[model samples]
Target: MPTEYVKRVLAACVITVLSISNTANGLAGDTKEYRIGLTSVIFADGTAFVNDWRTYLTHHLQAPVKFVQRQTYREVTDLLLAGDLDAAWLCGYLYLQHRDELELLNVPLFKGKPLYHSYLIVPSSDTKTRKLTDLKKKVFAYSDPDSHSGYRYPQLSLISAGIEPKHFFAKTFFTWSHRDVVNAVADGVAQGGAVDSYVWETLAEKDPQLSRRTRVVSKSPEYGFPPLVTQRGLAQRRADNLREALMHMSSDDMGSKVLQILNLDGFTVGNDDLYNNIADSIRIVEQGG
Candidate 1:
């Protein structure tokens, strides 16, 4: 074969391999099923939520939505970034870390507000300790290293007070969920932990069971709220359709029920401005100070 022809053939082969890899990895369109994978925080359990949201979305889109459940924030983020998942309900910090690879589709309007905050939780007995600095050298429980309210804000609070998480705590552990972190502290698994203040409030207000065990220690400064995100390069029309479904669906009684379960009043259009601080926090963690 001629050298020029050989070069052209090699480039074509490389492109073919990449296309096949992406398809095999769940990137390519297959059978036109409009599947939506939700990250953690959208569900308290597995089955009921997928059924509820799918009913809402598929009714509007006029297609069946296979609700795929992802176990953690990281897993959802990876799937969304890789184009394996069509959409995700994601926290601000996760979106911040991967915003370049994703687009904000919609944000949930929780309790008639679009923003939420974090809480520092110590035992109810530790009333005198009021600030981040006061808890140094204490055992701490974080839900996950990648969690926004559960890890990022608490870590950033410590760094702002001139303490690094690895150096500040006597020990650290992951409980994998906001409720678990709250339970760990109340159960004395650790001296304290951080959790979503919204979860704390919602559980306290709605679940008398969880409220009996825990109380808030302090509240972190508010940052951008969590959002619904779609993979970058998702078709613009599809993104618009999904956003319209969310924003306009809250007109009837059934729509209200879905919003109630999510602790949301409705859905709203949002942009990237709300998450800039989260990106700053990520940079702090990466720089180790």
Candidate 2:
């Protein structure tokens, strides 16, 4: 069963939190909440799943923590860049795009793997489209324009097949979240969609009825999972505290429970080199090779 605490923060609250000034510090010696930016990539409906994270971090950092939710990865990245957030969990694509201005905090370890894939999914009843090429001239969904799995890697697959996404699909739309992409394909709103494979699999376990309606037609090569990052100039002491909290999350009872809810083993320090594959993929897609 999903944790009961997951129902605490409704989507409206998340949006309201994002609209405020969430700076981590306000005047010296004054207690302030550490604002963490989260995009819809992982939590599309609400912020309940990460309620425990807030509790754990508050206890460890000895400061209040507020989760600032955004509708897209780009928005979260922008918040972090503008110093409105102390840290953010963002897609690997956006991390690489702004690596020069950000500092990697940690990368999640899922089932012992630091790598993840992008799934090209189609409706289960669609026998005509067994592979990506078969979906040519068909309506498709992409999670976000800046998403590596949703856009870049999928576009690379098309380039590999001697096709360009713009000229290949009958229609293409951004759903802004992997779950939305899955639903779009399952409901026949889109013939196919590209999504984070981890999100697809998680939904398969949590909502089989919705997930079962779609099938993965292809899987992109594994790349670094999305990472938690902070602005480069964030206070070293605070950054270390946040990193320590995440890395040791599996050691304590509350933290362990949060890790389990997130379907992650724990967090580990990650290097920028881990995302070179995404960088190379972006280059190929941009050069239209």
Candidate 3:
């Protein structure tokens, strides 16, 4: 049984869902409406990009939809588990953490595959770096405590190399977004940092100023990619409709425009097995790795 708090959250969620269903279903005559929700691990700008993506989904599904910006992955998962979020864009590790509560609508595609890596980075001019051990006692920035590549994967990488972030660095901070982590190192606010290598690579390849300021110190082994997910209890037909909308987003469509803004190629269908490695890593971290 869910706890009292979970029950309360679930109750609120049911109310919201019922209200939306009544309003949208009333107009549909016989068709169903899916109040799809979108959540991302990025900051406000990333949230806006997702909102644009949702706009395309709404048009494609011919139903009402909404997107919400989550400041942290943990918060988004909480909303998802409580049934407040109909669907979300989640990191592999985050999804693994709440595997029972949410299901993947599909995997998001970047340049290609449904996989990416983490990067340990320092300013290009910082001659004193080569490996994770080199940055011992240095100032470091992470995106968030719950972030996959940005925090968890990088933390695990350090542990694998025989260092725990809480004890290894002189001091560490979370910049809360991959872009800011890069900026922090570039500005010398941090001597080094960890970020999603994909975000870093995309920014460097596309944004000259950012590329000029930072350099990759190391990269983690590849892991499952981030994905667009929906709550587990969502109606199957509704989920399928949402998936179809995402999977078909082409360069000639609204998804294309949103993808252009988001620097993504598009989305693909996925399942829970994609994040097994993330679950393994979580166990490693929890066991004091």
Candidate 4:
């Protein structure tokens, strides 16, 4: 069962499923409406930012921007696959998992690069613990099952160290939000956790008191940042327009403000090579490389 707090948050989210019959005739001209899915992770712990981003995008594109929110990344991906959404910003892991079904659009530039890391963290008071092995038999919090940083990287670490992830941790739980994973560690609900570095760093900048309660034990090698993607069959011109709007955001005042709120430098025309590391990791973990 979800906590009452999560229930409240979920209730406020917007998720509209529209059919082709409802949008096809109206999407091409000046009134083009773009329905985009924002993965749960990108909600980034701020309603104000999400609202501002929607307003900016809607104005920039001269169209209605519908942000579809789901509680999980998988749900957002499903919306893309089902043709209910025009495009979505999803985790890199999901990109590789369904590479053939989704087409990459744009990748956000963070600190001038299109890359981020997985953070391994523990409560600040656990100074004696230094690495993954030190957390053996302790409780752990994971962000999401479909998240590479939150779920896959930690499991990969365990396997590389020759430890069984299932038996090594005394207990584990999924917080469904990377921000919540940090909260779980800081609050001592979990002694250790795996979280997205970008999310943690953003929180560290915006809320030092909370960030100070947890210490980063290690960071995974850099991986491509999460990216915007359209389904394989989306119209080329439609995808191109959305991609152009994102890549040009830094030059526009309102778009610049939205970037500041999200703490992203800008968006880039990132290529598949950016996610090669992730694809390689998938092979190593799945094929016993």
Q: Write one digit per residue (lDDT tens) for candidate 3, span 77-156.
A: 77877777677777887777777777888887777877788898899889778887888888999987877888898677
C-alpha lDDT (0 to 100) for residue 142 of candidate 1: 91
What is the C-alpha local distance difference test score of candidate 3? 0.76
TM-score, one value per model? 0.84, 0.87, 0.85, 0.89
Could you give candidate 4's per-residue lDDT for residues 1-289 as a string of tens digits?
5699787676655222243433664554645578999875563636777788778888767778888888888899999999999999989999989999989999999999999999999999999888888998999999999899998888888878877788899999999889899999999999999999998998899888998999999999999999999998988877888899898889988889888878899999899999998887787667542
Candidate 2 structure quality by residue, lDDT tens digits, 1-289: 2554555556557856754434423444324678899875563344565677788989988788989987888888999999999999988999988989999999988778777899999999997777898987889999998888888888998887778678898999998889999999999999999999878988887889999999988898899988999999898878888899889898989998877767678899988888999999888888985
User: Which residue pairs in candidate 4 collide?
Assistant: none
Q: How does model 1 fare in lDDT?
A: 0.77
Q: Decide which is better by TM-score, 2 or 4.
A: 4
Please give the CA lDDT of all the candidate structures: 0.77, 0.85, 0.76, 0.87
Model 2 poorest 10 in a row by lDDT: 21-30
lDDT of 1 at 16: 95
| Residue pairs in clash, model 2 | none
**Winner by lDDT between candidate 3 and candidate 2:** 2
Top-lDDT candidate index: 4
